[model samples]
Target: MRALTVTVRDASTGPVVEIAGDLDYETAPRLRQAVEGLALEPGTLLVLDLARLELCDSSGITAFIVARNRAIAAQAEVALTAVPAHTARVLRVVGLDQIFNLYPDADSAALPSAVQPPPTANNR
Candidate 1:
């Protein structure tokens, strides 16, 4: 099994978490902890860069859900970038593809449109 590595960096939009190695039952908590520790603000986007992710099982998927839930609780948004083909397939199979905003790369996902703006009187 590959050693799981979860690293976080600040981005203009929000935090960009780069998850490498295996994201399975063993290392899922690490991700949970990393996400829980983030100070997410409303109208910001939390981007998960999965370009180096080698594996992702059900537990890993659950971790992603947990991150999403946390983001929602903060009134922020979460997105997945550079998702591996296999993991992407599993996410699609479970219908999470509709839940997360998928981006081709971290740069694109961190754009202003990544997280929806607060409803304004004109938009309402």
Candidate 2:
């Protein structure tokens, strides 16, 4: 199994966590920990750059869910970028495709308008 590597970098939108290698049961916690350490402000977009991600198993998907929940709790948003085809297939099968925003790349996902805040009642 490929060892997991999680790296975090800051962008104008928020933190971008680039995950590489295998994201399996053993290495899933590394992702969760990396996400937990991020400072997500309201409206901040947490982009998970998966371009280098070699593999993702069920536990990895669960870690993604955990990250999403944390982002929501902070009133922030989450996006997945460059998802591998196999992993994307599994995510779609589980209906998570409807939950997390999917982006083609980190640059696109980090754009200022990538994730807009929901319209408030006053905006209606």
Candidate 3:
């Protein structure tokens, strides 16, 4: 099986994680670590640019969910950009597509400048 590689970059919106190769059981932890290490500030939007993503399994999907939760816990927003058709289909089937904001590309996701408001006590 091909090894999965995750490349992370900073963008104006927030941190942009660029995923490549296959995301599976062996590499899902790496993806999780990369995401967990991010210093997500309140009101920032983290974008996962998946244009280079090659493959994903159940573990990969779980990792994505974990990332989303992390962002929420940080009082930040998370978005997915450039999702491949296969990955998109999987996310949609699992109802995760509704959980994340989807963008056509990194630029589109970055164009938005509105800052997310801090989490209210009730929301937390």
Candidate 4:
């Protein structure tokens, strides 16, 4: 199985975590440790980007729930971005799709609105 890697960075709204590789029993703790270290502010949006995530086992699903709880305890919001179709299907089947806000990409998740504002007439 591929090893998991989580890269953390700041976005316009809050912190963005890019998760790559497999998230199984062996590597799930790494994600939990990384997330637990984040200093999330109240109302901040914590985006977890899984664009490159190769796999997510039961432990990984549990880790996601833990992350959601952590965000809630901090009074912060959480979103999952670029979830793989297979992963999304699993979450849907388990009804987690309703628990998490999902976006097509990190950029979309970081936006104040799903779409950008229109330019003013002055632009002409």
Cα lDDT listed for each candidate: 0.88, 0.88, 0.82, 0.85
Best by lDDT: 1
lDDT of 2: 0.88
Query: Please, what are the lDDT tens digits per residue for candidate 1 over residues 59-124?
Result: 999999999999999999888889899998998788888777788789988777655432210122
The candidate 1 region of ten consecutive residues with least summed lDDT is 115-124
lDDT of 2 by residue, 1-112 (tens): 7889999999888999999999999999999999999999998999999999998999999999999999999999998999889988998888888788888888988877
Q: What digit string (tens of lDDT, one per residue) describes model 3 on residues 1-124? A: 7777888888887899988889999999999999999999998888888888889899989998999999999999888888899999998787777677777887777775424322210122
Candidate 3 worst ten-residue window by lDDT: 114-123
**Cα miss at 119, model 2 (Å)?**
18
User: Model 4 off-target regions past 4 Å?
Assistant: 114-124
Q: RMSD of candidate 4 to the true fold?
A: 7.1
Residue 121 accuracy (lDDT) in model 4: 9
Cα misplacement distance, residue 108 of candidate 1 (Å): 0.5
